[model samples]
Target: MQDDQNRLNPSPRQESILVCVSYGPNSERLIRRGWELANAFQASLTILTVDAQDDNQYSEARETNMSLWESLSKKIQAEFLVAKNRSRNVAKTIAEAAKEKQVTQIVIGQSARSRWEEIAGDSIINGILREIEHVDIHVVAVQREIPLQQEDYEPGVQAYLVKDGEQDILQFDPPAKDAVQGLFFQSIYTDFNNGVFKVTEPGKVTKYQIFDGTVTRKLSETFSP
Candidate 1:
């Protein structure tokens, strides 16, 4: 009876999870999924992002995403790591990080590439599997409902929003000292400064609608992508 009880009630298995993310709207969803798995298995979690380009060359959206990921990692008590990939092999970099961390499981978001692109090129999943042994990988499906398109907007620039009786005004030039500072992305299709306004603070991104150089809605009415 004692032997049977010991066999049935074995000690908990040790686990470590690694979450790979890129600069996109789905990154947060992947991180959250990894966190859930970590909690379920009582595993240590690490969030990793591999950058092929130098930090100085990162776009405004990439920089903002990195900051948000770091903040989220801290809030969730997970280690956040950034790997600079000089060779531009993202899969190899991820595998190396997993080995160093002794990760048993990895969580990654699904590729955004079209079906034809996936068939023409080697998948990152296959590459990671080739480099590692005895590790489980989870690929969360990408969300198709997000409406953000980074390519549609110009490069982000420092801007301000000033409250003018019942409305907010967007200004590219220097504004009063009390105005809020954030990055503004103007639409390439529009002649006026009309695009997404993103205010990225620690662990949060607040997005507002901009039309004709004016904020048209409240923060609560706008999306956070």
Candidate 2:
């Protein structure tokens, strides 16, 4: 099952990441952050939704929102994660998944409540911290308030696809980074090549014409493969 070709560029058992999604006002925000951290580490992601005992019957609403969120995640360039729901031992389930999946990092949405308050209240996150201790954890604050959208802003850490006609990575010595309007989403002329693509950060232009709808996995054919 392990062909040399297939084993090429083996990803060092990529650190799987578990993202806990509480279907509250912060679910979308947390998932957005989950995608960001996962991409940065080149790790796989798992989305878990916990069903805490609540007063409202939100099954239908949760499903619809999750469906829309999943569909919208594809366009954001995140390696889509499948959703899992559980009605009991939510924190324990998250910890179990992390161990079973060989997860290296757990990304959680930092809540705005004290640990005591969370413990006394219905908070899966605080419980998770108490239950899991084997993996590295990253907590992201939902500072922007608004969820990220394709038209608005792209997450800083993201991957790209290499189409058949793509130019790969562009080497440009920009006059200055401030010259471009966007830090990681500005277009480039490519020396009159009639090609325009996003200027990845610092100053690397990735042409829009080349990627044939496949995620880029090669640094150079000689070394990458």
Candidate 3:
């Protein structure tokens, strides 16, 4: 009788979360906020990005940005997905992914890039709300960065990292040859060695976020319960 009753009761429902990110400087903030929400709900999180064009249309910078976001997603222990819009709209693509993942909550940034505006109308948020039913959406406010009057970062250059004390420090002009080669991006309006570093592994690429002069390899490492 006890065994039968336990089987009939079943386990509690698990929370499912989705975060939609438009590629931009503000995407990092959006991902962090989503992580916080997922932590609060004790939910499984998924990060999704949709491109209007096919994979062949992506430029080097676009590819780098996608890899960086994916790295960020893994750091937060969320599944990362990238989808292309062939026939449907961006909102529709997002809604489909949400439904597939059984997402109960969604997080998106209010300050999406202008490219998104060109592809979808200003009513993108409204469209998403209409498509997704019974799901809560959080619109996060992003502080926009002023575009540089002059070129801030040199064209993305080859750089690598070296172990220093407790953190991996990026060396732009390495004295030693055979250094691990990776693409380096510099941020505008900042004099410090700041931006994203990308390295390609066997079947995937890993992004190391650089701030001031330091970065944490911890984020790239797998998460544990």
lDDT scores in order: 0.77, 0.48, 0.72
Candidate 1 lDDT over residue span 1-225, tens digit each: 999998999876689999988766566667778988999999999999887667577588776767677766876789999998886567788899999999999998775323312533668888889999989999888754345644767899999998887667898788856787889988664456667788877666778767557775433333333
Ranking 1 against 3 by lDDT, winner? 1
Q: Which stretches of candidate 1 lie over 4 Å from their true place?
A: 1-12, 112-120, 145-225
Better of 1 and 2 by lDDT: 1
Best by TM-score: 3
In candidate 1, the residue pairs with backbone N, CA or C atoms under 3 Å apart (3 or more residues apart, or in different chains) clash, namely none
lDDT of 3 at 77: 76
TM-score of 2: 0.44
Error of 2 at 64 (Å): 2.4
Task: Give the distance in Å from residue 130's predicted Cα in candidate 1 to where it truly belongs.
Answer: 0.8
Clash totals for all models, in order? Answer: 0, 7, 0
Q: What lDDT is reached at residue 198 by model 1?
A: 85
Put down candidate 2 lDDT per residue, 1-225, tens digits, no spaces.
578867786766567776765543444556556667777777777665544535355577666546644543554444444334444555666666677677777776665223223544656555666777657776666433234333333233232322234423333344332333222322121112212234344434332321122222221121121
lDDT of 3: 0.72
RMSD (CA, Å), each prediction: 11.4, 14.5, 10.2
Winning candidate number (lDDT):
1
Tell me the lDDT of candidate 2.
0.48
